[model samples]
Target: MNTTEKVQTCLDFIDQRLENQAEQTIRIAELIIEDIKNLTAGYHQAMRNGNLKEHSELVRQTQLNWVNQLHDIILEQSNRDLSGQVIQALQKFVSNLNQTQMQHLHFELPSPVAREYDAQYQYLSQEEIELLMGQQRLFPDNNDSMH
Candidate 1:
């Protein structure tokens, strides 16, 4: 597929997966939509400059942005499984672009090992003490562990 088609696929994937109407999700969705628009403009400029012939360069760049953003979100979510899937999707998308368009793309998949260092803490979705009372036993006492 060309870059345009590949970009659309990645955008569709993000829209399907992350376009939740929640406040935070909506903000992210808007950011991604704007990024896509910027990428489209970049591609048009590149084509005009004769740096790219196929529209796939734009698509690849768009997918790259998604993968990069997904890495950040995965870090925030600490969801290893989902992060791996995103990496795989990015790899396949890049490989397809490279093989089909003869355009080499460079990207670094987020390292889970690096991310794990920050995953040592607990992040709560809600501040309700009652909901957490029963789960107290599952965590170490912060006061005792500090030293």
Candidate 2:
């Protein structure tokens, strides 16, 4: 498929996934938050116990387990949301292009739409330039212009 078609397909798949998985993503996030909170409380209780070293070690292990669980949940949810279609599309696109052509290709940002009251036509006062100098001197003074 051509680049434009591939991009559109990926975008359409993403839109569908977002629509379907919005609720599930929010639910996963809530569950993860609750799990982390419970883990933190357990760790705090372990810290306060008589068997400091052993309890701390156990808590540390438990924290690692919780982290891994959280990671798995996020990965699973993301995979479900994306469904791997975008990755497949991009792979196909890359496989179709030649090495030299791929190397030379670059994306350019679209130019902003012109406004009737754009700042380019408005003159900055000397004080404004001085104040802006501390941040960024966007427009150089006419006196500083190289003629």
Candidate 3:
């Protein structure tokens, strides 16, 4: 198979494995493994096509570029609501990455959240909860069909 097809194949296998795992960290590890697999596959494909021989220099450069390109995709975090622990784990992974590895890939660190919640709720300032039914002020008009 070509590089693209091989990468997709490996990704499929990793995705299936992720489906069985319940832990978020395990899934992330699988994703990292999948990236390594794809990069290896790309190298193998280049060798198979005899392209590596005709352009040895080009092949080396391309391999470096390809590895970085693949890393870029794996580093992306889709959910913005991840907890602090999860974010820290990902950051550690990025920090430990080799210099060549991060050339093409970049990690988007999750925004930090408040470590503790305030004991006092803001509702106390209101003094009382009003149960005004059919009150025009609470519920605005102009209802759309979309809900």
Q: Candidates' lDDT values, in order?
A: 0.67, 0.67, 0.53
For model 1, residues 84-108, the per-residue Cα lDDT tens digits are: 5775787687768668765455654
State how far residue 146 of model 1 sits from its true place (Å): 87
lDDT tens per residue, model 3, 23-57: 65456567657756765676677788876665556
Can you give the lDDT of residue 86 in candidate 1?
Answer: 79
Q: What is the lDDT of residue 97 in candidate 3?
A: 58
Per-residue alpha-carbon lDDT of model 2 for 1-147, expressed as tens digits? 987677768767776765666676577668767866876777677667756677667667766876886687678677865666666666666656656586898954333432344545556667988888855556666776775
Instruction: Write out the backbone clash pairs for model 3.
Output: none
The top-ranked prediction according to TM-score is 2
> Clash number for model 2?
0
- Model 2 Cα displacement at 137 (Å)? 91
- Candidate 2: worst 10 consecutive residues by lDDT? 108-117
Query: Per-candidate TM vs. native?
Result: 0.28, 0.30, 0.21
lDDT of 3: 0.53
> After aligning candidate 3 to the native by TM-score, how far in Å is the CA of 69 from where it should be?
14
List runs of model 2 lying over 4 Å from the truth.
Answer: 1-25, 77-81, 84-147
Worst lDDT 10-window in candidate 3: 110-119
